[model samples]
Target: MKKVLKVIGITVLSFIALIIILLSFLLIKNYLDSKKPIIEDTYYKNFQSDATLEKKYAGLGSYEVSLVKLKSEDDTIKEYKIWYPTELKSKSQAYPLIVVTNASNTAASVYESFFERLASWGFIVVGNEDKQAGTGLTTSKTLDYVLELNSDSDSIFYGKVSQDNIGVIGYSQGGAGAIRAVTEYDNSNKYKTIFTGSAAYSLLAKNMGWEYDISKVAIPYFMSAGTGSSDDSGEDSKTSFGGVAPLSSLIVNYDGIRNDVFKVRARINGAEHGDMLTRADGYMTAWMLYQLQNDEEARLVFIGKSAEILSNSNWQDIEKNN
Candidate 1:
């Protein structure tokens, strides 16, 4: 009877242990899921493809700027803007291209005005509108677009574009997309250069379990982020996002040469996320023209003059713990 009691007790304990282990596993999974940010509903209203609209409007001014639309393999309609100097003409219009990505929820059209400024500096600028949040219109989509543009280089839509001389630039969420693009799509040495503003702490975030790897990009990248908020409205957002902590950490770990890997420049002060594209004192464009085109004057303006202005600007600093 005592032997029988012992066997029953062992069985009960074994079952209890198994139940405890399963419950612990379930609790951990729930905790991890709770920690992640919930993706918000992202959608745009009255969306118009720049390609169709620009065709109807024709080209204008000394530099031509138009909207281009592309359809991905999955039938995803992506929007982008094209800009190039008029003096280059059609046949002589083989200008370098820059792909700009905007904030996570913002569209490429939001940064359209900056395209003109970049175009005036003698390069073709294309701003990609993010679809379904700010992950990217989709990496495969940007690659297909570049490939299509390359294949159809003789077509009127892309005839003037120099597919061989490709570059990319992005801000905020677009910056993340830019990194993803260069890492995954621009792998074939198609895009020789890349630039980003207020790049997300993707790698660091990924390392923390998010799984992003934009820092692996082995091209020339000029990256920057605001130091502080210019207005009071951005205070809460800035505090929550960790500001420049991720970018600074990435740069500190950046094992790249000045001419290769990535060249990162950060602007501190009360600079907000949207301010990265502002031409208030030519802070953003100056650096872009220099690195993207190897323009000496633009480089000086970008590194020398812009730094001075940023020094005087009010920006926030990322906290160390972040």
Candidate 2:
């Protein structure tokens, strides 16, 4: 009887050991997956022509900006900011409009660099003031306010905001809001593209019952994040980007020069969540120019020669759904 008992104990101990080994292996694999692959400097050089590169990456456009205190009826967007070219009125055609939401516990002005940079690219960027982490009501409200301004002949954006092109962007909580904007509000013309920076993951979404399936979104979506803890350690960004169908090229019908989808991961090795507030100069703009303006140089950065450069880096985990 004692021999039988000893045999049973050994079997149980062995089973536990095997379980621990399996768990340790999985943890190691996940850690490796989150790491940068390798470094290649030649592939990292500026790949665009002098003129095109300057136009998209330089942020040198002479654009003026304005800020407004919104009324109480504005849902969640209590305040807003606008950045437009000083020459907006001089142009015959309307310019694109892009709306932005801020990270939780911060205000719209915190992302002033983000809005102003996109504006320098010739889009009318509207930054929303929101503090809530779980709700995106503010994101949709920004566009609604733009529509109102565009319709009001007395308003500054009247006849100046292009209805055909619109963009939504956000960071952290606002990143989640940007996703909610299109998935919940569902407007094709107003939300032509969505770029999320270090988006809040499902845990936060679950707390508010605000989570939505990424598969439901049909537009071009780009997810950018830092592997650092500041960017949620790419926690949600990984899951979000991975959830989408790699057939995004067919879904959004991006330009014919590329065969891959518009959706992919831009995992910067050293970047953090708040770093997006001031940096992300070329990384974010390239996606916008590629999607909104169909800029060839920007497209090249995504899937062109510049992309070839990025593929050689071990500091970034650039992946697409497959």
Candidate 3:
């Protein structure tokens, strides 16, 4: 009887332990699965190749449009706008590609000024529209769009685009999208670099309680927050709590990872979110150029201008090594 009682007690404990372990595993798996975004099959088929792209574009000049379809392994069509130089260096020399995720969410026309400058400076500027958004923007649902554009069948883009030398520039929601897309995808370094302005850090998405994760990002990211963009706590209290603005605090407070990260500039004094894009500041141009092409002159320009835009003392610390 004593032996039987001891055996029964051991069996009960083992069963309880097994149940607890199984429950913990299910909970953990659920959490991780929630973080991953689903890339649907229909979305992949929308991509158009170079031959099909040239047919779609019917013009030629210093500024001509080229369409690129990022067809995923699953056959999804990811759309992109390729802005090529009016003249190539030579048939053999491929210009570096710059992928700009403009925050304006406007038509390509709205970005003419910035794109023109990039082209004049010798880059093949490309832009993508976020899902269900304006031209040249890309959304969280459309991240594979970026991946396919840099794929192997993209032979036309092979010699045309300088290695995977790519840069992503985003304004507003696009800024947040740029970071989130790369973080979730984990290919920023594999490509080249990223730049953002007047960023919306997806804190609102996470806090409002979505399962998006921007913390695990591994890339060289640069953010330029405008001077008056920070919402006061009182103002934040009165405003709706679920929008993108509330998340800024999350970004300011969180310090998960900062590998290949640099806060190149945080413009000060009357610098609204949109103004930074239009103005042809040497540093703004330089930072993009440096990140995209490793140009020393551009790096010098960024270092010099960084001091002026950065208002926070903390940012000063980040600026020192950058």
Candidate 4:
């Protein structure tokens, strides 16, 4: 009986110790994640080129950026964050708008610098606190809220958002959200272009209840992933043949879109899934610039024989039906 009691006590203490260790690790990780810069120059360093579109768009735009946060009653999408050009407050011009979907376990607050950078380029960027935004419901609702604000006479976004020129972008699970945001909702036709970074592939997305049908995607599309082990872990014979969004999966998605719809798909050579959020910012930004703003300089990066991305060393497996 004494021996049994001792064994029980030992097991309980071991469980407590394990829990403590896990808690400590989580605390440390949160602290480190918080310490990371809102924007890092290292990720964009490789894209810098004096004569290329990368040099200009990868860096900050001329407009100063500002952020606004609004509370929401929805439980899943608790709030919305809007990053815009500060000049919009005084300037009479309308700016393009981009709706950003958050990756799994992340929110707009966690990637403020990314939105700020895009806003600096003269785009109004919006995102929400939906950590599990794969469903697209929150993304659609957030867009509705923003459009409503655009019509409110007293709102800052009033008469400032260009209704016809809008885009949607996502990374990881949010990549799935971006797809559904344009394909699954009533406001689906509002987006002019879509971009995804390491979006969750079909198998994984279905398992997570975030399945998206790219066949319904009719607008300009740009999708990219990374070439790291985390993104290419599974074997062909396995049930889970790819990680988040492997080349094979991206190819499948690219093929699903109608041939007439403009689409481009590629992967960054050394970047991992997480690295894609900012690593591909140069081309990603240029895609929006070309598709939504009709910027001639940005167009050179995607079209013509001298298209920069095709020859860029950082990218591979380029496929596009222009």
Candidate 5:
């Protein structure tokens, strides 16, 4: 009896030790992952090679990029990071602007390459270091601040921001913030379009007090999520709708928007929640180009029977009411 009991105790101790080791490994892995950039060159290369639109817009654009930081006196407004064309100061024409909202626990710095890539496309991209940007308040204020800079002669952006051409984008929590930035704020009407990647679903958003009414979105809206397990909640028969911004949830938001309003929702075939931030860069950039810059080539990707995105195997469950 003593030998049997001793063997069982040893087995249990070994199992507990194994569990601790596995937990420690996972924690260490997560820490390392947080330190790395979400977008990897190999992944981007593979994505760009898969489709025409992705090949065209996924690469860096023609403009040389420059970055600037604006420190604030207000504690809530930590700081703002702006990425733009280096030639903006020498150009005579005002450039379009894009406001970016940060995901939960992620600052603008984590997405530096993304902003730089967007800026290379000739737009001024601005983001604040607000980790909890799901509220949209910081995003709205950042837009106002940039507009103020556009009017200040001492500012580099003075008279150089195309007031009529502005867009906003967000990822994860920032995605929820992007919707609110265009619907909940006084300057809501100022944004001509909005985009979100892996945005929190309606139920999760409400539980977190980041709820937004998609029906209130009057501007051109494009939203996307991933089909990976991380995005799946596994609570429903529609497994695609289980994750952070599952297909079911996306459908709810899409259907809520008026039919006349330009709205789209799609999910990357195998992309995880975090991957959505940069995995769908091609379509996101093309959407901005079509809406904000009126680029005909970009328009081809979203409109007409030959829409490139419609045929891309890397994407699934695409829905657009044009």
Candidate 6:
């Protein structure tokens, strides 16, 4: 009887120890995740071009911003938002459309600043209103809805939006889905390009049974990541850009580089998982303007003195290959 009690005590002690170890492991993991590098304004304080940020529109000028919300019980974009340039009064030009959603899966309201920035630059930016970032289907649906609107001749936006100049942008998992969307939905390649920030879906996508090829995408691919230690997006961008000579050509998105057909990879300093989602600053703005509008001044930022400005500010690495 004494031996039996001793065995029971030993088993109880062993179970208690296991529980302690599990709790400790969880605590450590939580602590480490909280330490991932994040963008802080102080990080850019010493930058030489910090002075320019104070000027209007990050020195790119501005436009009147407008918002449209779509919310219905039967709509895919239930409670979504669309930010666009309102200065198209009595105009007849089809503007490029840029769609942005968060991998964070929050409402479009959470990313107002980023969308506003894109819209101010004269691109129609749409975001899903729901927290459905898991599949990225809704993001595509948002684009389809806008395209449908553009076809309505009686609608205010009829013939005012370009069908071929669409760009899909997102961060983390949302970014991966955006990349996949280029091949999955737009099979004919309606989208002129793709821009993803830190989407390492090589593992997650497969686990979820979403098999996609990064190489099949033939459009201009622009990817950015932080040199920080965390593999937040599964290193999908880094791996894709570094996988092969033909697969990944490194070139900085600059003037005259586009005519040559190149891929761009930008490494940013102190950019955490959420920086681009909230504030990609002049970098994304310049890239979009260059890609969609063929804005020369915007091109200068990526390839000219303004490039120096960002170099002075926070960009650690910006290179591309054709």
Each candidate structure's TM-score, on Cα atoms with residue i matched to residue i, is: 0.61, 0.68, 0.57, 0.88, 0.86, 0.69
Candidate 6 lDDT tens digits, 89-182: 4678888998775565455665465676568778888887555454566776777777888898776678888886888786766765676677
Write the residue-wise lDDT of candidate 4 on 216-279 in tens digits.
9999999999999777775651375577888889889999999999999999888898788887
Most accurate candidate by TM-score: 4
Stretches off by above 4 angstroms in model 1 are 1-76, 86-89, 132-140, 157-159, 186-188, 203-210, 229-241, 244-262, 279-283, 302-322
**Ten consecutive residues with minimal summed lDDT in candidate 1?**
40-49
Model 6 ranges off by over 4 Å: 1-60, 72-76, 186-188, 208-211, 232-260, 303-313
Candidate 2, 294: how far from true, in Å?
1.8
Candidate 2 residues lying further than 4 Å off, grouped into runs, are: 1-58, 62-72, 186-189, 232-261, 305-315
Per-residue lDDT tens digits of candidate 5, residues 208-257?
88999988999899989999877756566243346788778888899999
Candidate 2 lowest-lDDT run of ten:
242-251
- When superposed on Cα atoms, how far off is each prediction in RMSD? 12.7, 13.6, 15.8, 3.3, 5.6, 7.7
Candidate 2 clashes between residue pairs 3 or more apart in a chain or in different chains: 36-314, 37-314, 38-314, 43-309, 249-261
lDDT on C-alpha atoms for all candidate structures: 0.51, 0.61, 0.48, 0.87, 0.87, 0.62
The best-first sequence of candidates by lDDT reads 4, 5, 6, 2, 1, 3
Clashing pairs in 4: none
Candidate that scores best on lDDT: 4
For candidate 4, report its TM-score.
Answer: 0.88
| Residue 55 CA displacement from its true place in model 6, Å | 8.4
Q: Model 4 lDDT vs. the true structure?
A: 0.87
The superposed Cα distance between candidate 4 and the true structure at residue 64, in angstroms, equals 1.0
User: Candidate 6 has what TM-score?
Assistant: 0.69
Candidate ranking (TM-score, best to worst): 4, 5, 6, 2, 1, 3
Separately for all candidates shown, the number of backbone clashes (residues 3 or more apart, or on different chains) is 19, 5, 16, 0, 5, 11
**Between 2 and 5, whose lDDT is larger?**
5
Give me the displacement of residue 19 in model 6, in angstroms. Answer: 22
